[model samples]
Target: MSSSLPLSGRVGIITGGARGIGYAIAKRLLQDGASVCLWDVDETALSEAKASLSSLGNVATAQVNVTDAASVEAAVQTTLAALGKIDLLVNNAGIAGNNAKLWELTPEEWRRVLDINLNGPFLCCRGVVPQMLKNGFGRIVNIASVAGKEGNPNASHYSASKAGVIGLTKSLGKELATSNILVNCITPAVIETDILKQMTQQHVDYMLSKIPMNRFGQKEEAAAMVAWLCSEDCSFTTGAVFDLSGGRATY
Candidate 1:
């Protein structure tokens, strides 16, 4: 099926494209024939990722902090200027919030999570939508988490932030559905990423045990979905939340 993938001339901007799932998605998009702007906070990783993806296809790098509105706005503009079009926007920049119980979590940590996970998407959407609406075509896929749907005991902040992303996706999706734009979200179970390092063994154990599939999700699988959703193939779905939960989620 992938041999006939249809995104031949799209331009995309993927936040957090420095590494992990974001980089995986970026690579997949390029492989499917898309010009990409890989944005991230880590300058070094962004450079490396850009260099790596350039060998696959056209890829540009931007060092921008998604949590900062000004930085995100400028980055969005730079992407548009450099690419000449913005066919896809993937709001994949986020941090795993504090793992403490809700009552024990600090305000700083909570705000950090909210700012990066929720507000970052908000800023990106706000910045990119006008261009999309102007062009009368756009595809946005936000990377949420299964934790958002079923709250985790120790990850209250992370869970809440993702829930907020889901809410944001729904609201924006509805608002833009009248146009030729599509907005969607994906809820993925534990995929292999450095974020796992932020979790305790007990936390990881609990997550693993709850998975009916009994294993971690692969980055390629999720990346495949992201690439498709960012393509013209996803015309019929809007305001939807897809699950890549390894059988751990049902609804």
Candidate 2:
């Protein structure tokens, strides 16, 4: 059966696209026929990601630290210069800073996590939204976490950052509601990715035990939701939170 691709002719920028869930989302978007620009902090990983994903379709690579406005702005310009215009944005770049109790966590650690996980998306949006507004169309997907909803005990930093992301999604969605731009977020519980290495074994076990499915989510599963949210098919839904927690989320 012949099927038409919904994202054909679209161009997208995926932050943290070098690996993990971000990598999977890039691959999925490519399969759906969108030209993808992979943005990451690691130049080596970005090169490897671009190489691996090139066979799927048009691909570009950029080194960006999303938390830095200058870095993000430069990347946006580069992406526009290369891809013409950005039609979609996937804010997936984030860090699972050292796991520790709220009291045990240092102020520096908290700021670092917020800078990358929360400030990163804000900066990326600030850089890209102007172009999207000019084009009159865009899709933004911020990858959040179930911890944002539940507030994990030892992961205050991660949880708080994601919660901010959720709040950002809602507010931005409303601001762009009348426009052709759609802003939404996904909250997944414990996806099995290299980011897991950042967490302690005890922390990992705690997260897994909370998942009703008794297992961590797959990167592909999260990627699928992102692909859909970025497509025209996702029209009418903006500033919404799509749950990918595998029965872990109550609401």
The TM-scores of all predictions, comma-separated, are: 0.97, 0.98
Please give the RMSD of candidate 2 to the true structure.
1.4
lDDT of 1 by residue, 36-62 (tens): 999899999988888777887888877
- Candidate 2 Cα errors over 4 Å, as ranges: 1-3
TM-score of 1: 0.97
Cα lDDT of model 2 by residue, 113-216, tens digit: 99999999999999999999999999999999999999999999999999999999999999999989999999999999999999899999999998888999
lDDT of 2 at 65: 88
The global C-alpha lDDT for each of the candidates, from Candidate 1 onward, is 0.89, 0.95
